[model samples]
Target: MGFDADTGRLDVTPESPAYGTKLRWSAPKLIEAANTTVRGANMRTLNVLSPAPGKAGPATAAAAPDPRPTMPVGPVHTRAPASDGYHQALAAHQATRPERHVDPTIAQAIEAQTHALRELSRRAFPDPDPDSIENTRAKRRRDAKATHAQALRRARAERAQRGSTAAGVQAPSDRRTA
Candidate 1:
């Protein structure tokens, strides 16, 4: 059944009196109907005969015999084969064509440059192999750890320098007492 354009629903209705009246043909019934129609048409028929037996029965008959007389067979016309001169000319032309060759040094240099570019690209944007949420988290953790470590080292160095400077300076009270 076709769909309704306005309601966007199938044409079938459960409440209709002929809702289930329409019967669908089974596979066997559909096949039988097709065979009957083909037989009625009297077209080509299958011939299951072995030439080795030599005594094979007549071919299957058409549903309707054709009354037209068969046409007489005539000799088939074909062009003569090519002469040897044509093939020789083609070979000579192919032999006269020059072959192109690349210098080995130039080819090697090109290959090396391509490899270098690929290596630089790989280093600039390293492959994120096995990309996953855990990998991303791990990378973030490593970056944070390195940043914290650098900050800690810088703070310690500044603190050590200040401690040394403070130790060199004597209090005014201590000077007076001296």
Candidate 2:
């Protein structure tokens, strides 16, 4: 990822369909969205359902403004640490607006999408017990290493035994003829 200080834009290469769009992050944004749920606006649902920008019907001189879908992912901006406002107004608007929610169908769709992605991830990757050996390949590898070590030990023992015997046996020509 590259960030431009001039334009304040981020440049990121796209990932493949399956891997690129995986939602691995946990964001307070989701909670915030739930709180700021527009009364009648289903932004995401509309983005999905409507025809893409410049693909709507016939292009007209004065038709509705070119439609732009709200993308699921947006660039994030990090703020540098700054002094807090000591006199910031607390609850400047005294009127209490009760919690509002998006359309039921849109909410259901959002939840369903979340669940589906989670299911895909869970099924793709499974955690195996660390204490117990489950994979046959690992077991085979361990067995092979053990067998090789045993072979090495046997060869060394045989060499030591032969060396000891050779040393103990007196050479025929070394006998004194006194």
Task: Summarize candidate 1's per-residue lDDT along 118-143 as a digit string, tens digits.
Answer: 99999987866767567888999999
Candidate 2: give the clashing pairs.
Answer: none
Whole-model Cα lDDT per candidate? 0.57, 0.52
Name the 10 consecutive residues with the lowest summed lDDT in model 1: 42-51
For model 1, the superposed segments whose C-alpha errors exceed 4 Å read: 1-90, 142-178
Model 1 vs. true fold: TM: 0.29
TM-score of each: 0.29, 0.24
Consecutive 10-residue window with the lowest summed lDDT within model 2: 42-51
Q: RMSD (Cα, Å) of candidate 2?
A: 26.0
Q: Which candidate tops lDDT?
A: 1
